[model samples]
Target: MSNVVARDIELDFLDHDFEFVGSENVSTIDSTYASQPYWKDVLSRFVKNKGAIIGSICVVLIIFMAIVGVGLNEHTYDSQIIAHQNLAPRVQGLESLGIFDGSEKMTTSSGTVEVNKYVSANGSVTGLEDTYYWFGTDVLGRDIFTRTWMGTRISLYIALVAVLIDMLFGLSYGLISGYFGGAIDNAMQRFAEILNGIPNLVIVTLLIIVLKPGLLTITFSLMITGWIGMSRIARAQVLKLKEQEFILASRTLGARNFFIIFKEILPNIFGQIITNTMFSIPNAIFTEAFLAFIGLGVPAPMASLGSLISEAFKSFTTHPYMIIPPVIVLAILMLSFNMLADGLRDAFDPKMQEM
Candidate 1:
């Protein structure tokens, strides 16, 4: 009787172990796993990449500085004060004309007087006294800090708008050519090749000269040639993706070409698109800046990073501070953007297996 009782207890323990293993297998095979869980895992892996995280933080901080730095400070971008000309940056709570007071003297027909002012240096004050320069005024006697911030806004704006235009046209052209690969594809590709053969800088320069040099013209010239590379990339991606089983399944269901190409394929290729876009932004900015530096971008009274650098170049021997700051900003921006592009490529590539 004791032996039989012991045998029964052993069988009961073995049965409990088997039951736990079966439950584990069932949970593993469950098909309804949430997407949020997958995203959390990806985010965790991404945050672990120190360089990528630092690059991302730099980009965010630069953008925030672009937006809020000017408003928080008292300088007006175009303000010129002869009285406050060429004053150094604040030191130990000492107040100067432009940096601290945010006001300057206005000259009248009779004489000079002061006004309780807002929007400093909006062409309000004239005949700059050329005394006590603050932050080393530009040739126009405008505050350097103010002009720098304004230039940031202009450069960023042009890049964003131009890239958006390129993305729209390039994606459309590439998708159409890739989805219907015959005579149409051949013709479109040949045309793009022709555009590619021409030098982009020459095209931009010619456009600037012909159109008389404005922000819009430079942006337009960039888009015309810029889309070609993106189109090629998109078309290649589409060719590979179109052959997948999921695409075949969608086709079997009688889904239209537009639905298959856009809804099915486009979503899958967004990772590539995002990476390309990030890479393209710096290219656009640099090209625009180079052109402006050469006197072919954004005409006078409108400032850009490149134009600011150009202005600095003229006086670099006299005032090294003027040239160095803009150049540093430009370099940092380009490097941050490139790093970010690389990170996106790593994160988004479906074939890339993370360790």
Candidate 2:
């Protein structure tokens, strides 16, 4: 009778509640049966958020495209298709056999050019029948596909490294300021305020003017100036959490200053820290790109999206391919990053779950 009553009640609840209905027949869900686990509930809610999943997927795909699509698969990014320079993308009918069959000859307008197989376009043969640059070519005729991917690799690298540096310094400074108030806090706050008053772009420009412009210089310029925002965030979090009973209890127990800040205080602020870090990435990437565009980023042979744009700008009137590809890629990267940041902000938002 007890078993029968229990079975009937379970069936009634499952029929009434979507959560119960979804978990039916799953032993793990059955074992809990009444309340959802915190992680499970969070994940369930997250999965329901299509935007977050889409944003995450975009982030993964872009990173993958920036890596394997750009890096390991290609033989030489700098390899010149000397004969196929200025060829429109994927021209058909000019297909030729490779090394084993020997380089085939194509009767182009220029002359009978010896080369590898012509890449295919749509089903129809292109007007550039004898031509075939997969991503077209620049005026000087560097491979667009290679250059774009290379730019992605460089941009992502700079963003990642610069953000890491900002996180460390920002978190440290903020925590110290918030936890140890009075003279130390006053001094650090004043220092940050002074630094923050100076425009970051102007500072970056000055540094480039004084120093040799390269990857390291670009990274250092951003790193040196980027910590202010994150530090302020950290300090604010510390101020809120420091006087709480648990913190006071920990202090009363004679915990070390470092342990109290890192172990006790920092953990509660982890969500904000993560959100701030995510927010910082696109800023760093854009800053680096802007600097490069202004003639202050990585030198040639090491290309960033911004520097690539600068190169493309030189031939915008004649060969737009050089400019178009890099600009499109830069736009996509920036937009995707911003979307991902928004998704992370929502994910970390405590208010959303409370609602």
Candidate 3:
């Protein structure tokens, strides 16, 4: 009788109903989720950084001015008008504010008195007062406004070219040295070390002696030592990445060495490389400026911020305006690049991201 009862219960259990729940919602579930691309994500994070945003804007504006500002005024960067020498800043709209009114404090029999420099220098302010020298005139009577922007253009051009060449050589050297981990790596590293051991100043001075002091010479001097830093960074990154499982898988799949290094590994390390590149730009700019400052910069008629500052230093006591423009522009440019680099670093490295 117990066997019959157990058989009856088993039969009842087999008659239970089955239901498929939420099968229709399968595709709709993932609709609310959005996919973000790597670069897009980086841009999103970079935009969140206010300092980076401001720096980027400032950098863009400065570059734009460097390109276009030279043509804004009638005076060319090298033009000399002795009659207008050392004239104070005079702007059309701002003159009414009493500043940049082409006036300077003159020490005379009546003691120091603010006098219209244009009037004193030209003997009549009539037609001359209408003329505007936004940043004033330099000792050579060249418009400071035009010269400052022209100098900026040269400095930026030299820095960008040098850094780009450095990146190409450094990236190739590092990738090769790091990918092959034995004798080749050792030899390359030793060569890099020897190159690095020489002081940059010495290298630049020697180059100046060999080649004429100009944009090409300064750029070449920077390239000599600049690649070392980039190479080391690239090598370090490649060394850390080459032994990873993906690289091994690629190797196991018979990928060529070039393909493995560039196709597989390069994409992974590119962010770091770009961040380092950004950091390098300001250094190049500062170096060029320093070289120019010490009389090793571009020759006359071709202005650079460094050369501008050097020229302004002589009459800085009496004509303080000359030094202020270039100094301010240089400071802002360097600071902006640094800030942008800092932002790029944080954006690229997830570990460095703020909580």
> What value does the lDDT take at residue 255 in candidate 1?
95
Arranged by TM-score with the best first, the candidates are 3, 2, 1
- The RMSD of every model to the true structure, in order and in angstroms, is 10.0, 11.9, 5.2
TM-score of each: 0.75, 0.75, 0.87
Compared with the true structure, what per-residue lDDT tens digits does model 1 show for residues 1-355?
A: 5554444444335544654445646655557855566446556666666767888888788778778866655667766665554333332233443444334345668787654233244667544333322344665667776677677777788668657865898888898899899999999999999998999878877786678788878877867887887888899999999989999999999999999989999988887887888888888889888888988888877777899999979976545557765787788888888887776776665356454
Whose TM-score is higher: candidate 1's or candidate 3's? Answer: 3
Q: What is the alpha-carbon lDDT for the whole of candidate 1?
A: 0.74
User: lDDT of each prediction vs. the true structure?
Assistant: 0.74, 0.74, 0.87
lDDT of 1 at 347: 67
Estimate, for each residue in 1-355, the C-alpha lDDT of model 2 and write its tens digit: 4554444434345554654535567667334457876556646655776776776787787778777765543434566646555544442343333222213345657877654334343456533344445566655556777777788888888778867876789999999999999999999999989888888777777877788778878777767778888999999999999999999999899999999999999988887888788788888888888888988888776777898899889866545556877788787777777766666566667475456
Q: Which residue runs does candidate 1 get wrong by more than 4 Å?
A: 1-41, 83-88, 91-135, 350-355
Candidate 3, residues 58-135, lDDT tens digits: the string is 999999999999999788999999878888888888878877788877666767777676664556545575678999
Which 10 consecutive positions of candidate 2 have the poorest summed lDDT? 95-104
How does residue 204 of candidate 1 score in lDDT? 79
Off by over 4 Å in 2: 1-42, 71-75, 81-83, 91-131, 350-355
Quote the lDDT for 98 in model 3.
77
**Candidate 3 structure, TM-score to reference:** 0.87
